[model samples]
Structures are given as C-alpha cells and as structure tokens.
Target: MTRRDMILAAFVATLWGVNFVVIDWGMSGIPPLLFVAIRFVLVAALVVVVPRPAASWRTIVGVGLFMSLGQFGLLYTSMALGLQPGLAALLLQAQAVFTVVIAAGVLRERPTTAQLVGVVIATAGLGIVAAGRGGDAPVLAVCLALAAALSWAVGNVISRRAGTVSGRGPLGALSLTVWSALVVPVPALALAVVVDGPEAIATGLAAFGWRPLLSTLYTAVLCTVVGYAIFNGLLARNRSAAVVPWVLLAPVVAMISAALLLGQIPTPAEAIGGVILVVGVLVTSVRRRGRSEFSLRVSRSASRSRVSAPVAETARAAD
Candidate 1:
C-alpha cells in the first residue's frame, strides 16, 4: 500500500474503533434503533448530492439491505442490550470468518490452510468473549451482535458479486448509503416505537443533549460514510487479502479507545486472547499472500514456455 493508503486505512481504523464510544454515548439519550435511523437519514442526505455510481437497481438495493439494514439493526440492538462497547468491537470482527465461509460455500472458492486456521482462532476468541461475559445481561443482545456479523459477511459477498466498477467506488458507496439509509429506517423506527414508546422517544428527543447528538453525527459521517469509503477504496486498490488485515487492528483500537474514554480496563483473559487473535490473523494473511504470489509466478512462467515452444516448432518446420 502507498503511504497515502496506509494513512487512510489508519484513519478508517481509528474512526471505526472510536465508534464504540460514539454508540455508547448516543444510546444514552436516543433509543438505539431511532439513533440508527437518524444516522442513516443523514447519510442518505449527504450521499444523494454526491456523484454516485450507476448500478442495477437490484445490486444496489440488495447491498443496501444486507449492509445498511441488517448489520446496523442487529448491532445497535446488541449495544442497547448491555454488550460492552470494547468487547462489542472485538466480537464484530468475526465477520472475517463469516466472509470466508460464505466465499467457500456459496462462491465455490477454495480456502487456504491459513484461512482455516484463522477461522478457528477467531472462533476461539469469540468463545473467550462469550465465556467471559456472564450475568443478568440479555443473551439475546449478544446473539444479535453475532447476527450482525453474519449480516456483514453477507454484505461483503454482495460487494464481491457486484464486481468491479469503472471509477465508481465512491458513487457506488453513495448509492448503497442512500439505499441503506432509506430502506433500514422503517424497521428501526418501528422497533424503537415498540420498545421506547412514543412518549419515551419524545422525551429522549427533548432530552437530546449535545454530546449524544454530536456522537450520532460522528457515527454517521465519520464511521459509516468516511470509514467505509476508505475501506472500499483500499479494496479497489488491492486484493481482499491485502485489504482485510486492517480489520484485525480494529479490536486493538477499540480496546485502547475504551481504556481512554470509558475507563473500562481489560481483563487478563481479554488481553491475552486479543494478542493471540491478532497474531493468528497476521500469520494467515502473510502466508496467503506468499502462496498467491507463487501461484501467479508459476502461471506466468507456464504461459511463456507454452508460447515459446509453439514459435520454436513453427521456425523448425519452416527450416
């Protein structure tokens, strides 16, 4: 990656990492679903004025459904139900394993041994987090977060299936954002009405102080819009193998942000497991890149030799 890309990736990571703090803050005054609804509304408004890519209504609509509606709906619900912010950040990275599974099973792609190992390690990390959290905390919320991870995995596949765009990454993102912002609010608003009640929601709105409001803005503009834009741009520049490792950095960023912002100290188990998880992801990504490079070299060499032999045969026949 270029220095610029590296910088952009870091910015994306920081934005995503800090989003846990934002979510926690915003959930204070606004109902989770309603908060999500507000975020999406702003995203829709911002992207509509931008140069978005042209795509079939089907692809655009499908991606927006999985990414915008499904992912955030489950995630916001999870947070509201008492999933800790730092840990929530870490668990969501399980999307990698979900993506790999979908790629192999649905897309008929082969999995590398390292990828297989990553799946195991990530599963282990998830197990640790699940094991660590015990209480009157709603188990449903934790399950919802897992659902969100699965939703995100499906979204990744949709983007892949959507294929390449001709300088339409930003435009495509905008279209997806608008579609997502529009389609998702219905369910979110509905859920918020049922749970928070009209009066409660009104009270929350009346009570909406600057902190929650600003935090909501940050979640919408920085984390969703800017962060996703950078991530997709990186994917456009490099293969998924190169681009996906940055996700591993998210949990670390989350842990740090949580420490600084919420003063939530990590347990020894979390700290140790986090290191292992990161190392495992790094190992898998590096080994996969090496194998890909080797395969490309072999394919190129074989093509060259095949072309050279046909020319040599033609020259000998002429002679």
Candidate 2:
C-alpha cells in the first residue's frame, strides 16, 4: 500500500474506533431502536445519491438485513442494556472468528491452521471474560454483543456471495453499504414502534438534541460513508489480506477513546482477556510469510545459487 493509503486506512480505523463512544452518547437520550433507525435513514439518504451498482435486490437486502439492521440493532440494545463501550468494541471483533467459521460452513472456505488456533485462543479469552463478568457487564449484554458479531459475520458471507453471483467485487463495498442501508429504516422504525413504543419514538424524535444529531451525522457521514469509501477503494486496489489487518487497530483506538472520553476503563481481568483476544486475532489473521519475508527468501535463494555456480564449474573442470 502507498503511504497515502496507509494513512487513509488508519484514519478509517480511528473513525470506526471512536464510533462506539459516539453511539453511546447518541443513544443516551433517544431510544436505541429509534436512534438506529434515524441514523440509517440519514445514511441511506446521503449515500443513495450515488448510482446503484449492478447488484440484485436480494443481495442489497440481505446485506442490509444482517449488516445494518441486525448488527446495529443488537449492538445498540446491548449497550443500552449495560455493555460498556470499550468492551463492546473489543467483543465485536469476535466477528472475525464468526466470519471464518461461517465461511467454512457456508462458502466452503476452510480455516487455515493459524485461523483455527487463533479461534481457540480467542475462545479462551472469551471464557476468561465470561468468568470475570460481574457488576458492570451483564451476561445478557455480552450474549447480545456476541449475537451482533454473528449477525455481522452472516452479513459478510452474504456480501461475499452476492459479489460472486454478480461477478463483481461485492458491488463495491460503498454501494453495498449505502444500498443495503436502505433496508434498515423501515424495519428498524417498525421495531422501534414495537419495542420502544410509538409514544417513545415520537418523544425521542421530538426531544432529539444537537448532541445526538451531531453523533448521528458523524456516524452516518464519517464512519459509514467516508470510512467504507476509503476501505472499498483500498480493497479494489489491494489484496483483502493487506486491507483487513489494518482493522485490528480499531479496538485499540476504541479502548483508548472510551477511556479518555467516556471514563470506561476495563477491569483488570477484562484487560488481560482483551490483550489475549487481540493476540489471538493477530495470530489468526496475519499472514505467516508477508512480502518482506518472500523478498528475503528470494534474495537468499539467489545468493545460494551464485555461490554454488563457481563450485559446480570447478568440479566439472576437475572431472
């Protein structure tokens, strides 16, 4: 990747990492479901200005269902139910594991040995977090977060499959993100009516303030629109392996931002578990032999060939 691309990747990661804090603040006054609906509505409106990609309606809706609605719905509810922002950020990375497993089953993409081992380690970290759960982090919230991750993983597969079927690279990530987002507002509003009640929705909307509005705009414009645009552009130009690893920095950024902004310091046990979880992710996702390693191997092989040439010629002359 070029230095510019690397900077863009880092910027996206930062935006995404700080997103949890924004969500927490945004949902503070508004009902979670209602807030989500409004956010997606804005996203759909702003981004749908772009011409639609050649993707099918099914593909757009499927990505929207799981990625936008399911993931955000569960995640928002999880936070409202008492999941801390920092921990929520960390736990959401479980999507990586879920994606690998789902791809193995649904897409027939087998997990590498490194990925399997990373899952084991990550599972161990989750076990630690589960054992240590107590006052602040409720079991239900954790479960909901895990469900969100699962939803996200399912969306990943849907998007990948849709891309395959369309014979295009997932109809451009930005297009999928925007078009799929069109699927969110109706169901989310309906769900808000059912769960939060029509009165609560009306009240929340009436009482919406600048903080939540600004939060919504940041998430919709910066996090969703700009972030995904850069990410998709990178994916188009580069390998998935290269682009995907940069996302690992997101949780770190989230944790720090949560600590400074929200005063959400993880418990000692949670911290230890989080470190283990991150390590497991790195182990699972990072390539064993990257470009530098390949270059080194090539150089070594050339050197060996050069050294042996003279010896081989001497032996032939002697014979």
Candidate 3:
C-alpha cells in the first residue's frame, strides 16, 4: 500500500473504532431497533447514487438479513443492555472465529491447525468474559454480542455463496452494501414498533436531537460507506495479506477511543480476556507460508465483497 492508502486505512479504522461510542450515545434516548432502522434508512439514501450490482434480490436480501438486521439489531440491544462500548467492540471480533466454525460445519471447509488453536484460545477468553459478568459485564449483554458475531459470520457465508452463484468473484462493495441495506429498515421498523411500541417510538423520534442525528450520519457515512470504500480500494490496489492486517488496529483504536470519549474503562478480567481474544484473532488471520497467490487473490476478492461494519471482523483468509 502507498503511504496515502496506509493513512486512509488507519483513518477508516479510527472511524470504525469510534463507532461503538457513537452508537452508544446515539441510542441512549432512542430505542435500539428504531435507531438501527433510522441508521440503515440513512445508509440506503446516501448510497442511492451508486449503480446497483447485477446480483439477485435474494442475494442482497440474504446479506441484509444476516449482516445488517441480525448483526446490528442484536449489537445495539446488547449495548443498551449495559455492555460497555470498548468491550463490545472487542467482543465483536469474535465474528472471525464464528465464521470459521460456521464454515467448517455448513460449507465443510476444514480448519487449519492455527485456526483450531485460535478458536480454543478465543473460547477461553470468552469464558473468562462470561465469568466476569454481573460485575464486569452483564451476562445477557455478552450473550447478545456473541449472537451478533454469529449473525455476522452467517452473513459472510451467505455473501460468499452469492458471489459463487453469480459467477462473480464478489459483488462490488458499494453496490452490495447499498442494496443489502435497503432490506433492513422495513423489518427493523416493524420490530421497533412491536418492541418499543408506537408511542415510545414516536416520542423518541420527536425527542431526537443533534447528538443522535450526527451519530447516525457518522455511522452511516463514515463508518459504513467511507470505511468500506477505502478498504475496498486498498484491496483493489494491493494483496489482501498486505492490506487486511491493518484491520487488527481497529480494536486498539476502539478501546482507546472508548476510554477517552466515553470514559469507559474495562475491568481487569475483561481487559485480560480482550487481549487473549485479539491474539487469537491475529493467530487465525495470519497468512501462512507456502500458501498460493491464488488463495491470496480469493481472500482479496472476498474482502471486497463482505459487508459488515468496518469494525466487524471477517474470517476470509481462514476459510
């Protein structure tokens, strides 16, 4: 990557990392599902100018269901249920491990030894996090975050299949992001109505101010759009091995941003668990020697197509 691209990658990572704090602030007065609906509605509007990809609606909607609806819905709810923003950011990285395990079962892809080890280490870290609940984190909140990660992993598999079925290596990132996002608002709004009730939703919307509005726009534009655009550009110009590792910086950024911006300090147990989880992810995603360039090419392609929050960790190379 060029110096300019390197800066762009880091900038995007910062945007994504700070996104957790933004979401927490944004959803403070708003219902979680309603806030998500509004966020995606804005995302859809912003990306309307981009030409739609040639992929089928089924493909688009499938990605939306898992990636946008399932992932964000659960994530926002988890944070609302008292998961700290910094810890939430770290826990979401478990998506990489979840993706590998899911692919092993559903796609019949065999896990590498490194991936298996990473999974075990990550699981132990998660167990520690779970044990710290009620004091460090809420048990329900942690469980919901794990479910969000699993939902993101499911989206990754659906996206990979869509790419294969379309005979395209992967759909264009912008197109996939926009079209899939269109599938989110309706169901999200419906659920919001059911869960938050019409009066509460109306009251929240009426009370919405600049803080939440800016937060929504920042997430929709910077974190989702600009972040993916820069990331896809990096992949287009360089090898995945060169570009993807930069994403490891996101958790660090998230933790620091949370501490500074939200005054969120992780407990000692949560901190130790977070380090183990990040190390496990690094182990799982590290490029092995003797792997073919063709495999790298596939990883680059997958990186471009997969849609998640910039902070949403992917397990493409592991697959």
Clashing pairs in 2: none
lDDT (0 to 1) per candidate: 0.69, 0.73, 0.71
- Ranking according to lDDT, highest score first: 2, 3, 1
Tell me each candidate's RMSD, in Å, in order: 6.5, 8.7, 7.7
Best by lDDT: 2
lDDT of 1 at 43: 79
Q: Higher lDDT: candidate 2 or 3?
A: 2
Candidate 1, superposed: residue stretches over 4 Å from native: 1-10, 134-137, 166-171, 236-242, 287-319
Q: After superposition, how far is residue 172 of candidate 2 from its true place, in Å?
A: 2.2
The per-residue C-alpha lDDT of model 3 at residue 286 equals 48
Clashing pairs in 3: none
Model 2 TM-score is: 0.79
- Model 3, position 232, has a per-residue lDDT of 50
- Best candidate according to TM-score: 1
Ranking by TM-score: 1, 2, 3
